[model samples]
Target: MKILGLIVEYNPFHNGHLYHLEKSIKETNATHTIAIMSGNFLQRGEPALFDKYTRAYAAVKNGVDLVIELPTMFACQSAEIFSHGAIATLNSLNCVDSICFGSEEGDVNILKTISEILVDEPNEFKIYLKKYLDDGMLFPTARSLALFDYINKYNLLDISKEKLLDILNSSNNILGLEYIKSILKLKSNIKPYTITRVQSQYNSETIESNICSATAIRKQLKDFTNIDSISSVVPCNTFNTLKDKINNNFDPMFDDNYFEILSSIIVRDINILNTYFEVNEGIENKIYQSIFTSSSLDDLKESIKSKRYTMTKVKRTLNNILLGITKYDMNNIKNIDSIPYIRILAFNDKGREIIKNIKNNSDVNIINKFSNISFSKDDKIFKTLIDYDIKASNIYNLIYYKNNRNLLKGPMDFYISPKYVK
Candidate 1:
């Protein structure tokens, strides 16, 4: 049976995501699909809008066969590390035949060329990148300039400078390139495919028709009780599942007390503000000033934003501060060469069979219960992140309606369904 791999956040599974999965399976001719999903935090350095387990359940309900947790270290990281971790997990599965993703430029060949350039890192590109960075361009802008210069110098304008610029500007295509790079770096045999996204701009904050961006959907939910405002954009099933949650007091992740905790942390630890991962000099002092002066996270971020420091990077640094993920932790996490274990979150009946097949054939640990297993140092760190996730979930629960809180008791594997096929 052919298996296809997807790396997703599924912050809230929607119609667009469903389309991607169905199209990917059809295009790849895969019999099964697996997704390595982000847990509590996402790649953009923000907490997920929904908890991982709930999102994983929604994916399985929508058609994903198996759902594995993307460790927090990689989940809240730069594109390169995010792609590396996701691809590494799929590679470790040993069953995935192809990895499919969405991109603005659906041409796989062009993506491959860009991936090769990035992976090989030629001297000319390096010199150009250094020059741009020394000129005070942010890393993303610097890299884009370097690539543009490389393409022009080599007379590769046939790739369409406009198209290349569009691809570079797109967050999805940028990540898609990283995915391809990871595949090449690992020499994985999995074929790559891209499906162009239909409708819904990536960062658009205005809800339009039935196809709306997540940003727009999120914004609509803030005022409207029901999803009637954005129902057309999501699958009927997904909309139904979320109807009650959206109508009556829906709290996005980190909506409750995130800034309060962030403020306290910033106030208490003045020295941690100086770490390398903190990035953009004097931001620590700026954060200290904003802790008492600013009213909201956005306001605090705005107070610190400068020409040299982008808002996204500043928010990410603040997140790192909130999580107590220091430069030391960042370095240690980066050095982890291999994924220590695969933590299964949820799976359908067929997914259980896939797990059994993997357990019988592969050498990696398949963790079901946290308590029954002895964890390595890397695994322990992952567990610590999970603990933080549970804390976040508990906090979210308190804000909506106090109920019997279901903290992740042990490893998710124990609670997950694991039946063998006859």
Candidate 2:
């Protein structure tokens, strides 16, 4: 039985996502699809529009066979760490045969080439990169210039520098390439595949196509009460789900309240801001200055923005601060060879069989409930952090209604018939 693995943060399950899921399975001839998804917070350092459980349920209802939560640490990090963590989780399953991701340039060779270059940074390239950084250019711009210089030095013209620069700008494709690098780094046998993204640009904020970017859809949802505006863009089921949620006055998991808490945490711990993940070269001092002056998350981000640190990077730093994840914890987690355990989020009949097979052949524990599991000291610390995240999510839920005030606990089972099977 072939199994296809996907790394996703279906902040909200939309039509484009459903299309990717179906096409990936068809192209790979896989019997089952497994997803390592972001929990409450996503890579952008923002809270997921929906909670992880709801998103998992939505995936199961659409087409996915099984879903596992990506630890908050990796889910909230940069592209490289995010890819590394997702790949590590899927590899630990010991059943995933291939990993599929969406890319603008669907050519596997180009992605592989980029991955190799990044993995083995040449001395000349490093020198150039350092020179550009020293000149006060941001890291992304410096890296792009360095890569362009490398291309010119090698007399390589088959791939345009403009094209390569575009790839570097595209965060998703860059991460997709990182996933390939990680597989090679681990000597894993998982094959790589890419599905060309359609209609929606990853970073676009306008809903122009039927397949709209999550950012555009989310922005619309904040101001409009009707789902009809995005009806053509999202899956019917997802549309209906959002409608019901709105009617019930249920706010998305990541709400303004969550950001407020994040802001408060940053302000209160201004002295220890550098202790969080990715805080370097006096970034913490900048954050302290911003927190005291800025009123909202967006304002704080703008106040602290610099040429070297992007908005996304600042948001991720805020996430670490809110979760109390220190620099030492980040180092420790990065060294983990495999996921500590598989905490099942949702599974169907085929997924159940997969779990049975895992138990028969693997030594990794499969956990379905919080009470059934005991954590080591390190694991306990991680769990406590996760619980804090959950509380943050619940606090956002409170914005909708007083009755919707409780922290979610344990793994949730969301059973639904697969479209193909049904």
Model 1 weakest lDDT span, ten residues long: 413-422
Instruction: Summarize candidate 1's per-residue lDDT along 188-234 as a digit string, tens digits.
Output: 88889999887877788887666667777767766563467767877
**Can you write out model 2's per-residue Cα lDDT over 347-388, one digit (the tens) per residue?**
777877777767776666676765555553267545643554
Best by lDDT: 2
Model 2 TM-score (2 dp): 0.87
Candidate 2 local Cα displacement, residue 381, angstroms: 8.6
Candidate 1, residue 411: the lDDT equals 37
Segments in model 2 whose C-alpha atoms lie over 4 Å from true places: 121-157, 375-403, 406-422
